[model samples]
Target: MSAPVLVFGWGNPSRGDDALGPLFVEAVEAMKLPGIECLTDFQLQVEHALDLRRRSRILFVDASGTARPPFEFQPIAAARDDSFTTHSVSPQSVLQVFEDLEGRPAPPSWLLAIRGDSWELGTAPAPSANANLRAAIAAFTAWLPDL
Candidate 1:
């Protein structure tokens, strides 16, 4: 059998909107899809790259602070200079690490970002952010069947 797909959700659960990534991963886990593995954590790291080596594909979910509006969810492919100096290692960097560690086939990868606000402790998402979360959940749910 082929290796399973990995869905990795990265973010801080203690921080308000930052938890969205993990939350989305939780939603995915609850679905219990066969041949897919779901992993959620506070952030991406070099260790995570090594852990994904056996998978055939990876879907990374996170909350980002780009120019896009709140709750924006988009799929991203690998790119040059993708390191995140402000946060944990970038997804692209992780993929690179995987390539270095394993000489064989590297898994296909994609990134999904949810626009977020209010990273303060004990705070909840604002109205707009909640709406975005709902949309993101819907979109992610729709993609689960095909995986």
Candidate 2:
């Protein structure tokens, strides 16, 4: 059998917008695609990096404060190093670690980042962000058929 397609969502749920990543994973889970594994976490870890090494393809969903207004959905080919200074390890760093341990041939990966506002506790995503999230989901769903 081929390696599975993994959809991983990472973020802190209590931190408003940071919850977008895990939320997206839940949405994807509802679709119940064969060969697709859904994993959600508060943040990316070394273990998660190892898990990614075994996949054929990986889709990472997260919220980004750097993104422009109205939420933006773009395919990220590489994770950024700056993520190390942030609350959690960046996806790129995780992939790099996996490569160092596993000797390359890592799965193809993509990052879907949603622009977010109001990351404080007890807060929710702004209305514009909510709409953007829905659009992002629709776009992601359309891409699945090709996979």
Clashes of each: 0, 0
Query: What's the true lDDT of residue 114 in model 1?
Result: 82
> The CA-based lDDT of model 2 is what?
0.77
Q: What is the lDDT of residue 7 in candidate 2?
A: 88
For residue 93, give model 1's deviation from the true position in Å: 0.4
> Model 2 reaches what TM-score against the true structure?
0.86
Residue lDDT tens for model 1, 28-85: 7787878878888887777776778668678888887662654554455444454644
> Poorest 10 consecutive residues of model 1 by lDDT?
71-80
List, residue by residue over 1-147, the lDDT tens digit for candidate 2.
334898889888888888888888888889888989998998887667768755878888888888765445544444447665667787777777677778774677787888787688877766766776787788788988878
Error of 1 at 142 (Å): 2.4
Per-candidate TM-scores read: 0.83, 0.86
lDDT of 1 at 63: 81
